[model samples]
Target: MAQRSVRASLARAFLYLVLLSLLSTGIAILTLASSLRDAEAVNIAGSLRMQSYRLGYDLQGDRARLNEHLTQYNQSLRSEALLNPGRFWVPKEVRERYNAINDAWADMEHHIRQGDIAWYHDNIAGYVAQIDLFVLALQHYAERKMMQVVATSVVGFIAIFTLVFFTLRRFRHQVVAPLNKLMLASKSIERGKFAHPPLDTDLPNEIGLLARTFTRMADELQRLYRSLEDKVQQKTLSLQEANRTLEVLYSCSQALNVGTIDRHCFTQILQLVRQQEKVDYIEMLVGENWLLCEGTQQESVPWQSAAITQQDDELGQLRWQASVGSPPMPLMQSVASMLGRGLYFNQAQKHYQQLLLMQERATIARELHDSLAQVLSYLRIQLTLLKRAVPEENEPAQRIIGDFSQALNDAYRQLRELLATFRLTLQQADLPAALQEMIAPLRQQTDTTILLDCRMPTQALDAQQQVHLLQIIREAVLNAIKHAGAQEISITCTTSSTGEHTAAILDNGKGIASLSEPEGHYGLNIMHERAAQLGGRLTISRPAEGGTLIAITFRSSSSDNNDEK
Candidate 1:
């Protein structure tokens, strides 16, 4: 069936009602107009009765105006209302009764004209009765027209009422109910749920189209809502990760900013990395030394490692055990790089301390060399002149003078060694460069080859340790130069896997005659003392090939020195 819109249905219903009302109006108008003519016919028929009585009174009394009464009666009987031929308002019974009155009046007229008063008296009542019957017929006709008017009015009202009732019902079902459902759906969407049942789309109306459109729009909205939720969740996770990265970086920076970095500090930084990256275990290794480690090692799981580098120098390795899709390499590497910088700063701080100590010792050495060395040299010269002046005459005085001079000479020599020891200075932070500088003057003094190989870790030695180690090496080299009288000195420094440092000074020189110190000479004793200050063992040995080797072995001050077995 063809679909009709609400507008068309309402308009059609209104048109039907209007047509019904018009039909009723038209019928009522026709009936009322006929009723008006019926009233006039009844009045005319009633006047005939009055005229019959008046004519009867004229016959009984003087018989004067009898022809006039008869003429009036005949005119009333043939009146337009009673005798009109084609008036549908006039009933057949009224017409028949009017014709009967006319027939009775025609006989009465003959008698009255021939002076027949007794005949007129007898027929007058019968003619009035016929006139009464005519009036009753006209009344019945008017009543019937009124009945038609009432019936048309009642039918029109009933049809219009039915149309209104059914139209309202359809509107409720097709328009109002669907619109309410749409409103409810809108409310459900507002609450972030698509909970409403499906709308009816099969109706052939605007409501059906609206329902289908609303359904599609709701589906699209639901999809968009889900998408938005996912996006929001993703953004939140991104923000959280960014916050964690920033926190790790900031904390690592704080840990590195201190004056000294130790195993404890590195452990803290690694812990921070573990917390941020959510790793199982993490550790830092500088060369073979594991400086700091956090969490237990799971050898079953392969570790993800990043080089801790600064300016292309790989300072260490950072290793951790994490899942396959762990945090990106850049973040872990960034943390590793930050730790590398911390190690660099630690080395630099140690160097700075060493430099300050060397500078202080040099200052003391300068003060002593300028004042005390001049006085000691002058005294020694004066004592020598006194000895020469008294030597030929008095043996006892000469002997005493010789003893004093020898004692003075020994004291002067010991003071000079002390000055040299105090004057030891490191011009740069690098140990290799400082060692080269130390050996430069010695190299110029002899044709012997002096090779220095330093391979110690940057953080292995502190200021005091470097000072003591340098003193020990210098003393050993000087003993080779002055006493051994040999050439070809090689100084090599290395670190073991257990973080132990070893420095060897070898020279193809005459071996020492005895391990004991010579009388009034304490070079070897002082060298041993310096080694003791480093908390190390100094060993002197003659190789089978006839070279003297002096080496010191000690653990690095920076490490726990636990060797992995």
Candidate 2:
């Protein structure tokens, strides 16, 4: 746990190496210095033998210069290098040899001075041998000092190499390995992961602190990256949902805004909702009328309902079976509103078509009255005149003339009735309203109690269907008024779920004798023809209470007829 620094450690290692180097250098210097002048001392000692022989030669051959040679020999014996016994390199054997040589030289000198030639010659060789011993000692001491210097140098070099090897290993562990880890950690962070091994924060170096800081930074980055990923996923889901919602709304709007909106169109809209929203069941109801329905009802689930409304007018209720979660109310409401507008537009179109048809019928009636009806009236007048012009006694001709006149009158009356039927005035596409208007004028002509009941849906009939139905009802009512003389009359109209229409006129008057048409009356035949035009059959029955009941059943429009259009 010590606060060790890389710089300080390196500095200490360097200083230790310097000290080791200095110690080795000092030891080599001291070792080599001990042998200083030892070589010179050996040379000077070897020269002493030569100097002794020269002195002996002088004693034998040049006795005139004998003192001079003796002075030289004394100087060589006391030479500073050889005679310094206080020096550490100087050996005791060399010094003892020097003392013996000096004592023998003193005796030789005394003999030479006393003229003893025999003593001088014998001691000279012995003295030379002692000098040889001293020189050999100096040589051995110098060689030993050189060997010590070599050993010291070798040890110092090995120690320095060992310290360098250990120092480099420590540097690799503490510095290089940790820096490599940091590099790998940085690369992992770049790849959006933290996959590297843990760093050694316990290291006693600056790299340890740096590793700890980097780890915390990496942790923060990873947390932020995860949070960002979660947000992106949520946003993707939200956008997908919004896109589906838009698709549903756009499809529904397209279905409702077409030119001829029908049950099929609404059914398609319901299908769009089912496919997009995965709903269980859906249906539309206008009052008690089910306009369009899809899917089966599931009693286990509650129904979610929205009003089919337009401009504050709630035309119907749209209901669907959904699970526990609430359905999209706003989208449903928008579809319902579009349905309401479609219904409104459908009614308006029907009314426009009815108006056009009525106008065409009125124009045809005016043309027929101006041409055919006028011609028939003129023919009737001519027949009357011809009858009066005939002879009074001719009975056969009179009978023929009277029959012709009656036939003309009947044809004219029928023509007038047909014209009135064609000129049927209508202000709206409502069948019920048209019925009421038709009955209003008849009510003024009859004191008979009359009742009307119409339960048919307004959208059940087309313009042609309305015309045929009204004509049939009028003929039935007129017949009841004219011949079924007794009392009450009732007109009832209804529609089935399968779009079949039924109209009945019941009377409480004299019952007809037969279903067959009477010879002179064509009203029954005409009513039957009108029913046929409606793509239906008519039934006439005499009730037991003595009244006639006339009823007609038909579809609003034949599929074959619509296909032709």
Candidate 3:
């Protein structure tokens, strides 16, 4: 970008130089031509004046000679001597010589006729002197004009040369030099070195401004690079920490898979969690249901499970409560209820293990969805097309080829779709928009009526809170649709009194049977987890009518409070 800017600037500078040179040359040529023409005119005028002076002199001399001849004839010679062939008007050279000798001859003749020789001589001399002065003035004028013409030509040449030379020099220094520097800097930056600074020197006019701007741009780029480096370093540390946590989680999962359901297994899990440098405490409960606690203990409360009918004719409940607080009476009651459910169903332990695995897979699927599924879809399409282009060979060959291709495509598409579903569960947009879009697909796939009564505040929610609320609401609605077996479901969201937001999913279906049973639902667990992560609470209840209600509440942002204020 910098190089392009410099090139454009240089191009403009070159054009300006060309125009200036043309203008200067044009003016110089005009002045020089004018001077030469004036000089030629002066020279011609000087020559004409000199000739006129000589003619005047000759006319005077002729008149004087005529007078002298008349005088001599009267004194001695015969009258016919005046017209004698031998003495015809004197030879042209002699006449011209006599005229030169005596200018103003016509005036002299007029004076002689008036009998005023002294006055005629005086007027003749004065007139001759005036002609001489006029000739001298013309000569002086011509000489001066010639000198001026020469001087003008010289000056014009010098000006043209000076303009051309300076223009080219300035083009090279201000334009070409800066352009080359920009190009070199760009190339170096492209090769991973961004250290070059722009030239800071006295430049011609606009070029100086451009150079300063380029320098500022370089400084900004350097700052951006430094900021990016810092962010990358921080992200690297975060990823490392995440990886270590995953490793430990993996190890625990493997141990759970190998070990039997016993106190030792639970204790081992708790010990491993506590071993974490960042963790403060760990607790586990097992019975008809189970509740595990990790990190610092603030409070625990009794759990109540919403009753959900299973395909099997068994009446059981299983719930898991994980909290980061001291054991409270209500939480302990919730845990005791979950333990009662677990004790009734021995498979509860295995089910809990599966839930953990599902959570991990869900997380992994999300990552794959964001990074790899798109690529795999493209590959699957390419492979399918390639397979179609190939002809069916012998029976065995066709069978093997078909089976392999079908299996690979099926696996690819299933993995892609699974990842996509997990991503949808995690990602969110505007609450109203997301709810509308989610219902579109659910309405197409299921017979459940998903009614959204979302009365969000006048101001929109923050992105993080919006996403969290959307996920919670989605999970609640899906649970109602799948487990409650409801033909109609309603989700209503509204701002709470203390500037908190709340969403409720209500269904006119089966409700909680016993205080310990919770609809045998995994989504309930997910909703609870999401709510906890958002520093909120999730509640499930059976209304007086035969239906279930899932309500979630979380604190609104400070900005929302300010808006209310």
Candidate 4:
């Protein structure tokens, strides 16, 4: 027979299980039927012997009982229970004993009919003895038959037990063991182990197929992992190059903030890149003039140069020379791009000034659209409702008109505040003076006592940092005065000994309750943005003195202190 797979084997095993169950049932039934038949045969044989004795007694002394005894004896000899059908295997010795009993009965009956009392009485014992022999034979046969049944039952139980044990063992080896291995492999995989032990695949079974599939899948994973490793390496190199480009650009931008993006800025940029990165030679060329050519001592080797472009005009070129290693083409390009912007340094300053003007105007427009516009629209709706209520000079109509008028006046004041904010340029580059000027108006506008604490270094912040710091302060103070219903607002700008600067706007307002600004509020957001521009952390909290405290703390050019406000 061809080797069976797991499916066929499983089916065969199940069939065997069913067969064993049926065989066990059949054995039980056979045991019961055979035991019953054997017992019945023994019982019939014993009855035959008793009937013979009774018949003999009747013929010798009691003739009235003779008929009954004779009828029973004849019936037992011919009983289907004893002489069973053709299917029954009757012992030859048992048949001989039955024939002897029949022969003895026939002789005794002839004597009994002739009225020979002495002959009949003497020969009747022989007839009964033969019947007793037949009884003994049948009893032995029944005992033997019972023994056979016991042996068969024992054999069947042993066979079934063995079959079940082997079936379970086979299942464990073929299915359970393989599954356990797979589970172990899965656990190892979780721990980042990829290599797995090979399972048996020679068996043309489901487990074998699974093992083969797992092997293929594992191979595929290994291939994929190898491919990913190569890609990751390439990506890592690309990312490192990208980071270098960004660092170069950032250093260039920082240089531009202090110095114009001119010949001087390019020299600082090339020097900054030289300090951390590998470079043999870097030169800035403005019409063949080497503005910057600084790096390690020159080793004669490969050189690359990128054009420095400003808009559509090519102003100059940035050059690099390496003995063995040249920077990536992209990095060179990025550095060139950085140098290109610096080539038109004067124009960059004008562009920056233009951007600031545009930003200030945009901020004013945004504030109007977000705040004053909404209030005016609401007032317009109220005016429409008021006209509808014109006929009725009710108190509600008067209240509506009053609210409309109040909203209109508030909107006008907001528009004025917005205009005043956007008008002043922070060219003075003085934090204390700007804060004082900003607070002077707020102080005149409100009953709030504005205390100014100006203990900052004279040149701690640059021009733009000062401007952003002042704006952040103005925004904080404005919110406190307008929204928190503050009675006294104190502004503080202090530089600690550790060089950290703290700018705080504290007010005796409803503190925490006013901190959760309503949606569409831009003043708070603008304050945060300005603080971020100053490289400071902004905080708004309620101090124990019972009002909102908005503070910004940052590191100045001369200091290195962490944010704490």
| Top lDDT prediction, candidate number | 2
Output the TM-score of candidate 1. 0.54
* lDDT of residue 80 for candidate 3: 26
Give the runs in model 3 whose Cα sits over 4 Å from its true position.
Answer: 1-363, 366-421, 425-428, 458-460, 513-521
lDDT of each: 0.79, 0.80, 0.55, 0.69
lDDT of candidate 4 over 53-99, digit per residue (tens): 66656765768767666676678777876654344466777777877
lDDT of 3 by residue, 324-438 (tens): 3323334333333433333333244433443454477589887887667776677668667866766766667567667767766666655654464455542223356556866
How many residue pairs in model 3 have overlapping backbones?
A: 33
- Overlapping backbone residue pairs in candidate 4 total 0
User: Between the candidate structures 2 and 3, which one is better when assessed by lDDT?
Assistant: 2
lDDT-based ranking: 2, 1, 4, 3
What lDDT tens digits, residue by residue, belong to model 1 across residues 404-510? 88878887898788888888767655567678888887788777788898887545576678878888888888888877778788999887767778899988888
**Total clashing residue pairs per candidate?**
0, 0, 33, 0
Error in Å for residue 235 of model 3? 57
Worst ten-residue run, lDDT, model 2?
556-565
> Model 2: number of clashes?
0
Between candidates 2 and 3, the TM-score winner: 2
lDDT of 2 by residue, 1-565 (tens): 3378887888998998999899999999988776676777778778777877776777678688888877877887788767466555466776676677777778877887776777778777776777777777777767877888999999999999999889989989998899999998899889877767898788877788778888898888888988999999999998887787789989988887777665567778888987778888888787553456677789899888999887898878889987745557877887788888877787777778778888998999999999998899889888889888999899999999988888888788778777877888777666788889888888899999889998766665666777778889988898889788958999998867566778999998888778899766688888899889888999999978779999999876553222111
